[model samples]
Target: MKKLYIFVLVLLSWNLQGQGLPGLGAGTTPNNKPILHGKSWVAITGKPLGASAGATIFNQGGNAVDAACAMIAATSTMWDVLSWGGETQALIYNPHTKKVIAINALGYAPTGATVDFYKSQGMDYPPQYGPLAATTPGTPGGIMTMLAEYGTMSLEQILKPSMDLAKGYPLEAQTANAMEAQKARIKQWPYSKKIFLPHLGEEREAPEVGEIFVQEDLYETLSKLVEAEKNALAEGKSRKEAIYAAYDRFYKGDIAKEIVRGTREQGGLFTESDLANWKVKIEEPLHVNYKGIDVYKLQEWTQGPALLQSLNILENFDLKSMGYNSANYIHTLYQAMSLAFADRDFYYGDPAFVDSPMEGLLSKEYAKERAKLIKEINDPKIGPGDPYPFQGGTNPYSDILNQNKEALASLPADQLNSSLDPAFIEAFQSGTTSVETADAEGWVVSVTPSGGWIPAVVAGNTGVGLSQRMQSFVLDENLNPYNLPEPGKRPRVTLTPSLALKDGKPMLAFAVQGGDSQDQNLLQLFLNMVEFGMDVQEATEAANINSYQMQSSFGNHEVRPGAIVLRKDTPAWVNKELVDRGYQIELWNKTSGPLNAIWFDWKHGSFWGGSSDYGDDYGIAW
Candidate 1:
């Protein structure tokens, strides 16, 4: 009996140890990380390294806007996969004004770029193809604009941390992994290779955790910008000239010329004139009403409108009554997503070029018509409906056909016998990285920066990357303008940052990294919070399901896999329901993209924050 008691005691002790704390000492989950003080606003991002940069700014008496500026600079250096000399968009919710102001830091295609240029080169546009595809980088300008207008600190103060970190910092595992993945591409650009490579020529082992990684040129660039900021303030230099000088030095001066020469030699279209003519435009964000609340999106130039359209379709359904993640709930969400994507593919584009009837599309009458079509397609296999008619012409079916053909042609020729040929890349395109913050005063900001498929990485310069963003044109067979490209015209973008307001107050500031998944993830995050009433952590960590079985925004006919991907922690019952709803449910051990979010609880006057648990190491602070 004594021996039995000892055995039982040991078993009990083991169980107690197992249950002591969920993520304690695990170092893998945010749940284990310490929470910050309640009143202080917390910023979350994909990397803790990047989050630390923002947190430092906040700790140093910076306001939410200042913190955002710091975060953007840090991300450009650390999270280069989704950041860097890319485009950016921001939505600021000002409690004082009780209004949301938007900054369209999105880069525009240069006036000189045209489809004919690519055709003349006898080369097809590769998705990841460089410098010729880049638009003017808008991130730096956007940061400066936001800081000068809404922030409390000077550019020098906001950028100091980023500059220091760039000079030398230990590479985290995530950054190292990304560097290795793009090692080949990094090698192609001398400046990139110098910073990312070990010994400057040969591929070296990734820096161990805590080992310092340095980018002296990037540091110099940040320093130059800071110096220019000071000069602008002290030397009577115009803000425009200072901003132009900073960007010009990075792009057109030495770095940009190298990139232009290299790309032109390789049959790319980037020109000196394109660089000189490039500018970031500030435009009005698209707004729609949902549940009597005003929701703003980044206008027709990006996929932001899809979020509104999805919400409109969802408004027709009783999501709250359906039970969160239930078969009915998931089905309704998927249906709404399908309808919105249909419109996104057919209509959404650079509004300056495409006559996207913003009002007609968001109108209840149009939404009802679209919703009825969604109901008609119960099979889930049926794709999007015809686009709404314009003044004289019907829906643009030919464009859809062309996009579909291009997607099909992109398929690997070796996969002729394969049953599953990806009509388009399942992964998101036009990568966007985001930052979110809400202060005690109720000022909330969500900013997303993105520019991809722009062959902008100038050779020999770590400071500048030229964008090749002019390829999004609708043209005739003769390579003439079906839609003529124009200056200051915002191109089709995927980066969109959003804010959730409840009763005229900021509830949460959220954004995701995937190109198309940005809106889908945002929608799911909203449902997880509002309908399911899950805490911020659970909602972000919850399993998500998306369909490739339909047409994507770029007009790729995705074979709807009807698959549902859930975080490993998802409840078994939720899985059963998803399967019952005809979803090919797959449980992912870990997903890649990070969803950054912060929640403001008015009832408790406390703030709760959470970031992606998939792999990113992020935390909150007082």
Candidate 2:
């Protein structure tokens, strides 16, 4: 009997240590929502309707890829801070190929979007709204491509939920209020005014909460896509070819014509050739092995590699020993993030346009060298390091690096120490939404889709919103030479989706929104699970620290050196320790995130889905 008791106690201790439940040394609160467990499938996204769309697809005998596409379509149609005109970036873990791939559906700058043109217009950066700020649409192409390549469902079946929604759905209070708040901007676009404001002359022009918001134009546009697919299928085209037929219709056929005409009518720079030529790229994703797990991210075009770099640096420390959310752990993470983001600000851009030295930047040796620079106190003046040497190449932009350092050094002391500007915070935490889906069939997808949020300019009668992603570009080469506002060049964006594998099997699929803070929140979420052993739910809803040390990807591209955001419930001792370390701390009731994740519980052969408490993020599991 004593032996039996000892055996049970040992088993309990192991489970607690491995799971990191409450009171098991993991600094996480009781999850606001319980973890969703599923043996067959799970769908989680930014909105309930979006999750339901994915669940509907799963119920109809679809894989994770199909469900994810459905969720993307549904969320885009619902205007969940994104629309069909926005860009999509996804990381898909294919169960058959046993490999992860990246979907690069980011739109490039349209015709006449050169830095010289913006300079001639007396603007330092692209306009923030309206036609002048739009990029060529990419979401339609992205959804079609993913569906054709890995999905096992017809385009009609996959898009039906969203099509039904485009006709009309009960408007949520959050989206309704957002439209009302930006009604003036929506009114500026004739097509948007026609759809968004039902009672223009009244106190509330936007639709009321729970009102059946009808979008006839959007419904018609979606119908065109389905019609194209149906026509191709009737003509004896294969399933993949039929999907491509829909893709071509959106990118190169009548739909493209309407989009270009509508954009031009609103003073936008889109041309017929621009729409016809833009295509989605399916490429091998980048990965770095930390410990025994392989972590994957999209290429240099996004802020993804920053997370990998942080992992490489943090791998050098014993994070589990440091305790979760401890002052030392937080400082280490901040320093590592600052170092990685410093490199991102200077080196990350479209690989087609710039040699970003990614091979060297992700090297463990390079991370070790960068990690050595982290001191006890915060270093607000940290600048990008020369990664060329690590790659066995000479730094071509050495002078630019020095200039950037000098410019940062020249900033006023007060500006560096001041609290985060409201404008800056708003832009830094700008728009986006995430979709995470998994199935028993072994397919998993993580997507971060954004642009064309509220206040977007709807393109004429097409009912498609124009992407405001052009504002991510910098007009001056000094800011980011590789990401200059050149026509046909893709902008370096903050959208990122993450996947990880352990023992050559899917371990976690996760993503989040919040523009520049995407990777910051993602990094913490990852560490919370892997290092601290918190379950998917606790890790996602757990409080995280946000560092404003890197340059913002939106608005004026400003940076707030040494600024840190902590949860209001953070211990006072922790705050004192950080302030003593030369940090400017702000305590918010909530840190920025609505992170969604699916943890593949290989031991139990099930999936654990987590949708953070913030926002309307929801999930379904069975």
Best by TM-score: 2
TM-score of each candidate structure, all chains considered together: 0.81, 0.95
Kindly list the per-residue Cα lDDT of model 1 for residues 201-302, writing each as its tens digit: 445544556678877776776787766666666777765456545565545666557546655654455566656666556566676677765667778777
Q: What is the lDDT of residue 344 in candidate 2?
A: 90
- 492: Cα error in model 1, Å: 1.5
Write candidate 2's Cα lDDT for 1-622 as tens digits.
9999987876675545433344533433346798999999999999999999999999999999999999999999999999999999999998888999999999999888899998998998898888989989999999999999999899999999999998889999989999998998888888889988998899999999999998888888889999999999999999999999999998888888988888888789999899888889998889999889999999999999999999998989999988877899889999999999999988888887787899899999999999999999998988988888888998888899899899988977776754787788988999799999999989999999988898889887877888999988888878777788777888899999999999999999999999889999999998888877788887888789999999999888888888999998778999999999988898887774899999998888999999998789999999
**All predictions: root-mean-square deviation over Cα?**
6.6, 3.5
| Clash count, candidate 2 | 0
Q: What does the lDDT read for residue 313 in candidate 2?
A: 89
Q: Which pairs of residues collide in model 2?
A: none
Indicate the TM-score of model 2: 0.95
Q: What TM-score quantifies how close candidate 1 is to the native fold? A: 0.81
